[model samples]
Target: MNLRSLTVLGAALLLAACTTPLQPGEKRYSAAELLALKPADLSWPATSTVGERALREAAVADIRARLVLPAGPEREAALPKLFDLVAQYNAEIAAARPLLLQALPTLGQRDAETQRALLTAAHTLYATDAAPLIWPLLPQLTTSKPFAIAAYTLLQADGAAADRLRVMLPQQFPSWADDARLTALMQRLRPSAAAQPPLAELLAAPLRPGFPVIVSLQRPGRQVMGLALVRDAGGRFVRDGAGQLFTSPQLALARSGLPGTITNGNTPQGLFTVVGAGTATNPNIGPTPYLHSKLPVEATPAEFEHVPAPGAAAWDEALYDSYLPPSWRAWPPIKEALLSGRAGRDELLVHGNTINPAYYAGTTYHPGAPQQGCLVSHEDWDAATGRLVASRQLTLAQTYAGAGARSDLAGYLIVVELPGEGAVTPAEAHALVMAAGR
Candidate 1:
């Protein structure tokens, strides 16, 4: 071959070496062999949208090819991707049903991580005909004690399953009924008749002393777009050049489209402490500076609220409870961050999207993209020059920096679900802030 052609071939080989998974050999892995691969190792190709799309198609094909194999660990490996695919790419595997149903009977024999994946996938596919297989296993699954959390999470996929969970709760898992985390989940299962505290009440609730608060008001529906309103430390709503409350449209849906309670689900509704600000290294998040924050268990309540936590204990349910007003204290869904943090969810942030818009063009929140349980704002980047043309996240970061007392760019973020069908308007948000007073 000519020197130029040889050089082109060398570059292609180098690219392949960098992007493809390296194991014992280049040949396809058996179901059992693939089990040894860590979930992290199964990540998307770290290139451009083309690379992402290529890996997605290849991974989906690989999973489908393995699904038809005889039932075993391959099924376990394939199971999680069912949820992952739907969550990340909105792609539902057509071949998962038979494999899932066949594997359901023996699901209890698998390990903890496998069980979690199965339960998560079962929840994702619950709307399909997998309910029968899942229902029978709920007793066995919940009885595992260790897996009861996953079982409870699975039931939450459908409201009809709520009654079943209620019946099983007292009998099957009495001890956890009053536990804060379980209580939060149960309240989600069956909402309370008590009314939501007025907007003014939540706004007036005590928060961290030094930082501004960004209140993200989303719809009860997780997928709908939401609005975030910022309140300065002095308790006044920040306004824009238009003299209206400064608001940014944000989406809290997880890339996996799972509920916030799950590992990488939607953004949980509750308080988060914005401890600092920095740019994300993740390609999906691009170069935008993210408002770094922590969930309840991830940071002590004392640290979370920028106050002295009385108890010697790092954090407890009561300490978490103390931050909210009495009205919000009774609300179950508000405890999601506390419970979710305890469940090992972490790394949630407020950042801007750098994902290729073409990928999600027709979706519900097209201009905005779902994150891995972080708050996402819309951004327009000039791809050719790799410069940010416009960014809501940078604007937010500026707002936080402007309001915070310290150099850490610290603040508070409260995510609340409003009882409505549409995005919270600037007028509605401004009026609510006005009612709360400075």
Candidate 2:
């Protein structure tokens, strides 16, 4: 054979040798195994032109091929690995749904544990994308505990989607009436449903004459970053030359879970008008209270199942009743309901961290670590400047207080969640509120 042909044959042999074969009795790759494979390895032909969605699609196809095993231990083992791959890539549900449907019949015939996993994956995909594709499958899985929990979570957090879900599948709502946990969730959800305005309404709503603050916590790519925009008296969001909101230097100094239904670690989203301000002395964080709201506390369900860990109770308590600056509170009726315990939690605040400033400066402080739910910012001591660098929380409190002094109307705080890939931008937020009024 010619040298050119021999070299091509050698390369093919080398490529085959490098590929890891399935383990003994293993029908598919494990999560670790799949995660270890690079995007290039998963993509067709190792081409750089393959986009992220295409790469994810190829991975889903590969995993789906391994799922052909019969309804038994082998297939059951393969299922989790497939799910792990799907989650890692955040695969487009539209591309992955066909494989999920193909596996359902076999999965249903398997043991209850296997069925639960399948349902959980379906619920996850639905939650991740809010895709309608999973709706048809949800009816069948409503009886599953995992599915019920998932449905309750989504329903509590999203007003528009929850309304639609109720209309589309009325039976699914009542199915969980007997479940104690779901019952509690439903009770808490009622108030949230009443309190949360529709997205369109929220987007279009006019800024109260006083200073207006709009906070958008969006999952752009993977990390969720929050942008705080303040409206001038003219009702335009303060922006710089590039059109980015003129954000406080300390932006998202701490992290929280997505906005909506209050989990201990999650920040709740809604419209709040500042009502009262006070100082509270706490042993952990010291005496530095500014403004406080009942919003976070009232918004939280009395009880919700979260992944259990140490410090969860403390984290929830802090988020529910933490202090804010003097200028922040909800409108009268909402305030009364929250205070009376008829609605949301009390003591929610825009506040600083409990950690020592000396150790925390120039560092991202996650007070509750993996489970902090409050809207918190950090204070840093700038040694060179010989001054304390205030957080966005402080800046916002001061800005609103100033705006309140100039106008009779109270300033409003609107927190909204932006889902599904940069769905909302800071500039868009200003346009939305202004357009809503027009």
Give the top-scoring candidate (lDDT).
1
Compose the digit string of candidate 1's lDDT tens values, residues 28-72. 322233223332232223234556455556545544454555655
Best by TM-score: 1
Worst 10 residues of 2 by lDDT: 13-22
Q: Output the TM-score of candidate 2.
A: 0.39
Query: In each prediction, how many residue pairs overlap at the backbone (N, C-alpha, C within less than 3 A)?
Result: 2, 14
lDDT accuracy of residue 78 in candidate 2: 62
TM-score of each: 0.79, 0.39
| Native-to-model Cα distance after best TM-score fit, residue 188 in candidate 2, in Å | 14
